[model samples]
Target: MLTTSQILKKVKELEIKSKRLTRHLFTGEYHSAFKGRGMSFKEVREYTAGDDIRFIDWNVSARFNHPFSKLFEEERELTMMLLADISASSLFGTVLARKKDMVTEIGAVLGFSAISNNDKVGSVLFSEDIEKYIPPKKGRDHGLYIVRELLTREGKKKGTDISRALRYLNNTTRQKCIVFVLSDFLDPGFADALRVAGKKHDVIGIKVYDPMDMQLPDAGVLEIEDAESGQVARIDTSDYLVRKAHQDAFFRHSEWCKQVFTRAGCDLLHISTKEDYVKVLQKFFIGRT
Candidate 1:
């Protein structure tokens, strides 16, 4: 557990870092990468040489005996929601930082980016239930508040229930928005909810992981505790078969995650705790463009 002073110090650091990155790295890329809702008809004007003929208002044109083109404006303001997982499994890490730390940092960056682009930012922090919600709002202060919460807020439950989070999001918001589900994705049985959310909103899955979650070191027999259940089990890490089984399970879980995201028609980005997330985000933004 982090002390009050420690959490405050870390929050300040993250705010500074997120602000800098938002300005320099994501200013333009993030704005252009994702589009808002469908364009709204602004007005009708005399048809220009380059205007698309399909948009011509036949009734108006027939009445005036001249072609009229319908003009549309893009919905500039967008709402971005972050569904953050605060499960106990996020506390585990080996060679890198904890999964929770990575999620917090990435979420901060994204929040800042959204506000920088004049988009409304909101979040739902969950651990087997909806823990807290910050309604969509504009401005830098809102982003800072989200960063602070991500740094200091404690989970009420230890287990992960992504389905509950998704269902909550689906029911609460009627507006179409961009949603990012950030988690280690250790939970199962969320595919149906995810599919529903994707159909209604633009959804993205950000999977944060640690190296130890994928492989176990050969350090002889050790007692392992389940972070969510608090159940302990002794395993011989020195045994090749044990390590192999662990690796296989990890791979299978990862593969299933990929398939789930694919079936839901949502974009998935995997980030390791040890890697620089800015580069990963940049690549994703550029790829979308």
Candidate 2:
């Protein structure tokens, strides 16, 4: 548990870091990567030789006996929501940083990016249930406040229930928006909700993981506790078969996550605790461009 002062200090540090990255790294890439909803009809004008025939205004063309093309302008305002998993599993990490820290930093960067693009940003923090909801709003102050909440807010429950979070998001927001769900994705039975959410909104899944979560070192006998269930078990890591079994289980989970996201028609991005997330995010944005 972090003390209030510690939380405040960390929030300030993250705010500074996120602001700098948002300005120097993601500003333009983020804008071009995600466009607003479908273009709205402006006004029809006389069709030029190069005009797309698909956009020709047939009604106007018949009235004037000449082709007229419809004009459209992109919708400028966009809404972005972050669905964060605050389960206890996020507290486990044996690398450069904890999973919780990585998620918080990523959330900050995303919130900053949304605000920079003049998009309204909001979030839902969940752990087996919806824990907190921040309504969509614009401006830097709201982004900062979201960063603070990400740093200080702790989940009451330790288990993960991503389906509940997705359902909640679907019921509450009617507007088409970009939704990012950040987690280690340790939950089950979320595929249906995810598919439904993806049908209406642009959904992306960001999986945050720790290397140790995938494999255990040969450190003789060790006691491992499940972060969500608090179940403890002793295992002999010195046994090669035991280590292999753990690795296999990790790979199975990873494969399942990939399949789930793929079936839901959403993109998946993975970040390890030891890697620099900025590079991963930059690659994703550039790929979209």
Candidate 1: residue 159 lDDT (0-100): 95
Model 1 residue runs over 4 Å out of place are 1-4, 41-72
* Candidate 1 residue pairs in backbone clash: none
Model 1 error, position 73 (Å)? 3.2
lDDT of 1 by residue, 1-289 (tens): 7888888799889989988998998988898888877699999999999999999999999999999999999888999999999889987887668888899999999998899889999999999989999899999888888988887776889999999999999888989889999998999889999999999999999999898788899999999999999999999999999999999998899899999999999999998899999999999998987
* Candidate 2 regions with alpha-carbon error over 4 angstroms: 1-3, 40-73
Candidate 2 lands at a TM-score of 0.89
What is the number of backbone collisions in each predicted candidate, taken in the order shown?
0, 0
The CA lDDT of each predicted structure is 0.91, 0.92
At residue 63, give the lDDT of candidate 1.
96
Candidate 1, poorest ten consecutive residues by summed lDDT: 90-99
* Best of the candidates, lDDT: 2
Residue 143 displacement (Å), model 2: 0.6
